[model samples]
Target: MFETMALMPQNFSLPDAIWRLLISTGLLLLAIVILRTLTARFIRRHVTSSELRGRLLMNFRNGFLLLGLLGLALIWGDQIRSLALSIVAIAVAFVVATKELILCVSGAILKSGAGSFNLGDRIQVKDFRGDVIDQTLLATTVLEVGPGKTSHQRTGRMIVIPNALFLSEPVINESFTDHWDFHVFTVPFKREDDWHTAQKALLAAANRHCKPYLESVRTYMTKVGVSRGLEVPSVDPRVTIQVPVASEIHLTVRLPAKPRQRSYIEQAILSEVFADTDYSTEKP
Candidate 1:
């Protein structure tokens, strides 16, 4: 205990700042009281009307109060400035310490406010594509959808992505519609192997596979277009031709299919088309 006492300051007293503040406060209060008393006395003596005297006294007291505030502010200006700087530094430190947490909360707010995705919606943020299983302020739990976008089936993996990712990455909601939506798949063929016949075969496969939900998809697309005031694309089983290279032709097929059955529908269409058409060209 003696050693601890020895370690303490030998001649401890209040710092100069505290002493200065106390002295200044006492002096200001005293000055205000004395000035107010003198003003009241002078007003009462000079003013004949009681109302004028009261008004003058009140005005004088108010002036003194204002002056007292101004004087105190001037006296403690340095300390107040130091305190403001300290507060700002502490705020900056706090923000830096919780940067990621702040971002996550902000992302959650953005997602909710903008209606980015629902709990069951299939969403892709950056490379992470899955159905949202759960969501919270800091993270989102997803049932992993696929190894790639082509596969709609889950891979039996759960991904916990930080909500902060939503702020930085673009979110792709693949299953915006309730059930059936238009899905796109590509079927590639050699340019020399009867491209016309291959295109016809791919269209036939798409039409055949997608016939059940075609009308429903079209209706939904029309409803969505009317609600959003925008022109939605055709939901018909249409085929678009793309030639990325001189030797190859790609038949891009768009058709109606459920989100969960995208891969199966695509596979079935491609299987039927491939079995029906042969695109083998022997290079000389």
Candidate 2:
């Protein structure tokens, strides 16, 4: 008898299971609606206060809705679980297929949220430094800025960097000044050279070139300090001495100049200082 029963096919069918769930859900909803309607009518007839009756009806409806939802969830639990599993599988496939594109979009979002830089702003990312010419969700277009960092000259080549790089790398915004800002350069001299005289000569050249913008830069820096709630360092031209290696001494010179004229000002100061001060021991 057990073998005969086993040989008979079991009556489980997907269509039947779905139909059963649908029917149970429909019946449960019908029961709740009928109960709510009958109870609401009873409350309206028995309750004298309109506001209290209205509140009771609302509470009953909300309570019945909750019960209906719970009953439906119970009726559909197995199918809902299967549907959720399928959805999860689809989501995993979608993510795997579009990983890079997703990262690029996410990077674009990060850039917008951080407000890191804008068009015409000079920015450096890892080894790439350039002026941002265009931006999109997938990539950023930049006009290359350097044969070297201090060159401040464009290479006339456009580089399209994947926005995804912004996620992993830090962006350096070099265009910190709107009108005026500090510019720094280095002049290397022999350790045996007249260091004091060299310092005086570089300072003189810097002061001569930077004198006109001193007051304006100071005013701008003062406003920046006030807005940022910090004391800004002096914008006046200054030179500091650094001995990095045994053979050479470096004089670090800082001066205030417009952002667009940093290279020009630096070259001018360097030319003048070199002309006036001789670092070489040999007579030229």
Candidate 3:
């Protein structure tokens, strides 16, 4: 009779403790649910902007859930330390296993915030030059430009580069602020050819071809020079003579062009130079 009476207290206490834990957990969960619902409704009704509403809801939901979890942990305080240690171990293992994935995601975040490049911008990374078509946390998709072709024409190929490359490789954003690039071509002629006439002809051709963009190019270059500390060169077409070989004279023409139109402009200037009879005639 004594033994039975002594054991009854322990048995009753165990059940009482369990019941208290269950009740507390249920109340906490209920409170969390009510809080979530109320906050979500408040956000939806009061927040006008979709972006702001989404941000508020997400923050409130996470905060409320964290508080609920903390309350549950307090109720089961004895197991909290072990649970935390287990979570830390699992997190460390996951990070170690997915280090590359983490780096790629980090790179994506950096890219978005840094404004290194954007969709529809032409960028060159290492040997790959293309227009950005798609971007994700893991990779950036580009419509491939010239590889074997001489021009910056699309090659009809798509390339998916891991976002992690942005962290390690140099990225050249051709369309960063100014979409213009310099296009230069060298025309070879006989040593006895009239160099001055050739230079005049090349300059005229370039000016005629690039006249429409002269004002815009000048404004863009001025802004770039002020911001980036780069020397603002004249937007006017320039010709330089090079005599790399004794037997031939080379006339080089430099003009401002969009990256995609470099080849086209070069071809146009060459056609004009060939058509100029005065420049084409050899001096005896």
TM-scores, one per candidate: 0.83, 0.82, 0.56
Higher-scoring candidate on lDDT, 1 or 2:
2
Q: Note each model's CA RMSD in angstroms.
A: 4.0, 7.2, 14.1
* lDDT for 208 (candidate 1): 83
Q: Model 3 scores what on Cα lDDT?
A: 0.85
Q: Show pairs that collide, candidate 2.
A: none
| Count: clashes, candidate 1 | 0
What is candidate 2's lDDT per residue for 37-85, written digit by digit as tens? Answer: 8999999999999999999999999999999989988888888999999
Candidate 2 minimal-lDDT segment of 10 residues: 275-284
lDDT by residue for model 3 (1-284), tens: 99888867664545777788889899999989998999899889998999998889889988998999889989888667878899999999999999999999988988898899988888888888889999999999999887743356788999998999988988888764557777777788888777788788889989999999988888888988899898888878899989999988998888898867887889888787776575546556
Tens digit of lDDT per residue, candidate 1, span 212-278? 7778788888999899998988888889999999988888888888877888888887787777556
Candidate 2: where is the Cα deviation over 4 Å? 1-14, 37-53, 194-196, 275-278, 282-284
- Top candidate when judged by lDDT against the true structure: 2
Candidate 1: segments with Cα more than 4 A from true spot: 1-12, 37-62, 275-277, 282-284
Error of 2 at 153 (Å): 1.2
Clashes of each: 0, 0, 0
